[model samples]
Target: MIILVAYDISDPGRRDRAAKLLQSMGLSRLQRSLYAGRGGAAKARDIARALERILDSETDVADILVLPDHAWSRRIEVGNGRARVPGRARPPGVHIA
Candidate 1:
């Protein structure tokens, strides 16, 4: 199970809280608003509920993406940067996706 959390929070304090909460759950920060790590669907739901408590629904938005661990086998990455999406290294070439 791979849990990817992406959020757009309106408040700085809320954003930091969300980041810390995700990190505490073992998800690493892939970017300012993205995180990923090993977790189950139940965990994802629970995290979503937790976010509901932490976020202002009218102002903030968060997405908790739950994917099977094996999904990474087909992971495609591009752009001039290190592999932001975990579970595999970027293949050599110019990947369009």
Candidate 2:
């Protein structure tokens, strides 16, 4: 139930705003422009909805990946020295909807 949230926000102000909103929703800043959290489907949905509201105010592209429990233990890392939570069992499964 660890969710990986990534953002490609260009505006610092809006990016900070979005980060704050996500943090308020129980997400921890795991790396720059990346967030992590553990929650159920309802919480995930709520976070997605709130993220959309924040992203709507800007031109940034934000994505959320609901990582399954099985992938939580897998050791995959991103470029910025942060471990990657399996975003999807299949490639390009980023939940933007």
Candidate 3:
């Protein structure tokens, strides 16, 4: 499953730490302050909790988005489409054409 993590941290140190934490959990950065990761439910949840601890009260705001695997097919076929939402883009990580 793919999980999207978006954060708007004012502290540069905190922001970088969050990004690194996500990356360590197999997240490939999509944009500045945005991360995309793929992992099992337990791992994802654990990572999110760890990040929360790191941020503590310094985080201006953060969001851990758990994406539904059903929405994503095995690969992006010919008819595979895209969707848009607030904050960041839809598909954040590697895409197989």
Find the candidate with the highest TM-score and give its number: 1
TM-scores for the candidates: 0.77, 0.70, 0.64
lDDT of 3 by residue, 19-66 (tens): 788878877665677677676678767876887787756547778776
lDDT of 1: 0.78
Q: Can you list the residue pairs that collide in candidate 3?
A: none
The RMSD of every model to the true structure, in order and in angstroms, is 4.5, 8.1, 7.0
Model 2: lDDT equals: 0.70
Lowest lDDT sum, 10 consecutive residues, model 3, at 77-86
Q: For each candidate, what is the lDDT?
A: 0.78, 0.70, 0.68
Name the lDDT value of residue 25 in candidate 3.
82
Displacement of residue 17 (Cα, Å) in model 3 is 0.7
Q: In model 3, what is the error at residue 39, expressed in angstroms?
A: 1.7
Q: Order the candidates by TM-score, highest first — what do you get?
A: 1, 2, 3
lDDT per residue as tens, model 1, 1-97: 7888899999999999998998888787666787878788999998999889899999999988998756744555455344544444332323565
Best by lDDT: 1
